[model samples]
Target: MRTWRLVRVVTLLLLAVSYCEFFHYYMVLLLCTWPSVSSVQGFQSHPLRAMFIGDTHILGSNAHWFDKLRREWMMTRSFQASMLIHSPDVVFVLGDLMDYGTESSSTEFEYHVQRFKRMFSTPFTTRTEIIVGNHDIGFHHMINDKRYERFKEAFSAPSVRLISVKDVIFVMVNSMALHGDGCSFCKEAEDALKNIKWQLKCSKGKLDQEKVAEICEKLDIMNYSRPILLQHFPLYRTSDSNCSTPDAAPLEEIDIPFRIKTDCLSKESTDLLFELLNPRLVVSAHTHHGCYRLHDNGIPEYTVASYNWRNKHNPTFFLAELTDQDFIINRCSLPDEHTVFTLYAIFAILLVIVIIIPPKKQKPNLGKSFTPSNKDH
Candidate 1:
């Protein structure tokens, strides 16, 4: 009886844990899908609204089952986001366009892009740009100039590009640059970063200005209201400080350890970039979980969740409305119908198998061991 009771208790505990997982994400979806009552009535589309996606990791032929699952789930979730109210005018694909991006994989890459395009449901209407990711360049967690060039040929996108939405600037940086030393692409990225400073010089007043006569006069050169930095890896896992430990797990996904582990970005370079360009917002995706916090400078930095991750119950994307007053960012979950169904089905099956089955009865003795006998004593 005691053993049966323990078994039941264990099953109940397991069920509770699973329920919390589903409930947490479902609630997130519900909350994000609906706008507040005031916004529903008064809200109109902003002039330059944008949608941001996390790492896609689009898989190709002869890939593992998980990769295939990731691809399909991401497509469904992305489609759902696009269909929602206040849909984006421009969609920014941060990076990781392919599982292991290469010119040789161009066919697979193009196919994924087309599928993604269809999913977004804005093939021709909405403008979209993809930046280079570490995988896109096949740099072994670093940047390879040759592969970077080939990635451009494969996709016809620059390694680093600047996008403008009204007065807001989205600077896409090639995160592969800081993956290793002696990277030629790093130099190219530097020049690109330099150009960004010049372009956003007039927007500096928005960060902190008394709006004095001199500052107001300089506003003529205002080509941007604020700058948003987009990249693959987070600058530091948090808004402040650096995170680089060789002993830390290799940042690669599901691969047997073979290469020397290194931090996602070099502390030196990240510090320099931060010093040179203190962006109004920083968004990135590499870790499969999502995070939103403010940098030491009070700038918002978001580490987005991967759509391909099943464990990350709340697969998320971002929506931004660049209003005159400020930029409002909302994180929305990508609802995966199939996964949700599978989870519930498994839970139900476990309950029936464990709780519905009865334990076998054992012989009972009254204060003494009972021997098999021909007749009862």
Candidate 2:
């Protein structure tokens, strides 16, 4: 009986440990990332106050407005608190501004994009950059130039554009064009890369060659000014090359497609780009999973968790405090519903255990019956 009791104790301990780990993540979702609690405005002197959210996949319509409204409302509050405190200048959406790049016409898609813009216009106040993802261009499919052009114009951005603010320059690139598989916009993408390289080399800390490079002088760019590279894909799954990894993680199948594996960036191109670009920081969205890790070369890279709750993964995003040359990444995505649901699950299992196992009844009846002689009954 003692041995059985010891086994039971050990089992309980193991379960407790497992639950403790689960509880930690649950609390983070409930407290740190939950949108109900509006964010505190950050300091004003912050260089660039921006929120980075990924893969909204918002199904914008009357039927789903409630969910959309609540999520964005919470996000706005969070953004405001970030601004009130961190003082971000804008929002950088990693990509997939539309829900139906797969089927919707360019005009329809553009309308949706504009709607998205208007939705955030009130809260965002400043500029909000919407990067294009595979979903925006049809995942793993060649992009239609006509559609991509319309999308770009609607957003009033180039295939690759640069934004300069407070000694920081943000370079946005369309990775769909960079696939190097004879994509329609491949030439434009190649040109964009060349332009970026030239701008960085000749302009030296200035977005325009004509403007004086005060930022370069102030930040001492003669040495090396690491620019922030934004895109929709990652270079590597595990290694720390400044390139992107696949948009999706490796599946459990025996064989996967070559294109799928290198869908984000080919190893050869990744290596060349790293040598040419030398991006100090890499930010991307594709994988719903949230990640922050340094490249093998030491540049920090991140994949913000998807904002949409429709995915199998938990909703996640990050509070990026862009410190001078590096980034202070604070992940805030795991949400209230997830926590509540997890808690309920754990409780349900425990309740079932209680219900299923009968309680230990006192063995008193047997003792009394056996002790009849002592009672002299």
Candidate 3:
């Protein structure tokens, strides 16, 4: 009987340890319920619930097996739980889809894609949009036709394009091409942006349809709204010195001056985007930290933190309730890595103690048994 009791106790303890190790993700989701969105008067009855994930940086050749498995599991659990709980209308993955993306061969890239798909699989109704990051292809100096072609083939990533959800328009750009250097890649990106500008102008009744007959036939330009600019790099900024957000870049990096076209888009590139797109808001991710900057023109730009635990202990993403005229963005953090691991460690310790310690033996039926025997005699 003691043996059976010990077996059951050990089994339950093991299950407890397992829950702390894996199933704790769901608990985090239950605890961090999606932020409530304020209803705007002019907005539709239901605003678009858009989920924005920051740089995932899924590892490639550099990852150890255990590290790769652990990170992927965490991401998969968080993503799955978020989808199940939030039921977002759209998911925007804000670049850096893979670490060493530029270094991966075709086969390696395919494997990475498969892994990403497995972790981030969504329902058919939930649309996903991905932006191009420097890591996915390369920095301006390292970008080439071959690398660009591979990424484009895998993701269908155009240099710049426009996406419309409900009445909201999102102008997604390949920020890496905003180097301002007139390379072949840059020229193509520049041309695409110019085309988007013309389209926007046409939508606002500033351009004659007769002059651009080709583009006019492609869509009902009059129906489009002012765009929300989406890109991989933040606009020109000196540094994060002025950012006061809790998730802003580390204190050590706060005062470090940013390099134009390295840490952020060049001044000229930023100006061109603002002049052309006339965006209502801007969203970017690359620094793996959160930042909120109100540009000089009064436009708000939000830099989302990384979604992968490998990047930080407290990974985070954005939840934006969007409309044609207004938006509400809430920064939601994933389960803390340290907390999750600590919980698992504690449970594991309890499990080890349970297995090591013997179950207490029943202390004496001594007097009772003797009395029964004497009465029978």
Per-residue lDDT of model 3, residues 144-199, tens digit only: 89888888877788888887888789989998898887999899989988888878
* Residue range with the least summed lDDT across 10 consecutive positions in model 3: 368-377
Write the candidate numbers in order of decreasing lDDT.
3, 1, 2
Compare the candidates by lDDT and give the number of the best one.
3
What's the best-to-worst order under TM-score?
3, 1, 2
lDDT of 2 by residue, 1-377 (tens): 45555565567656755554344444454454211221233443454555788777655444377766656554444344444444346778888765666566656676677667655553445667778877776654556667677767777666677666655677787766666665557767777676666566654544654544533333323323557888877665533222233322334421333253334566655665676677888888776655566767887778776766554345656666553354555666444456545765776676567555655665555443343366554
Per-residue accuracy of model 1 over 278-377 as CA lDDT, tens digit each:
6778887766556665656787777666666533544667777664335667777665546666776776677676666767788776686677888858
Name the better of 1 and 3 by lDDT: 3
- lDDT (CA) for every model shown? 0.61, 0.60, 0.84
TM-score of each: 0.64, 0.64, 0.90
lDDT of candidate 2 at residue 2, scale 0 to 100: 50
After aligning candidate 3 to the native by TM-score, how far in Å is the CA of 263 from where it should be?
Answer: 1.1
Model 1: residue 174 alpha-carbon error in angstroms: 0.6
Error of 1 at 73 (Å): 5.0
Model 1 score (lDDT): 0.61
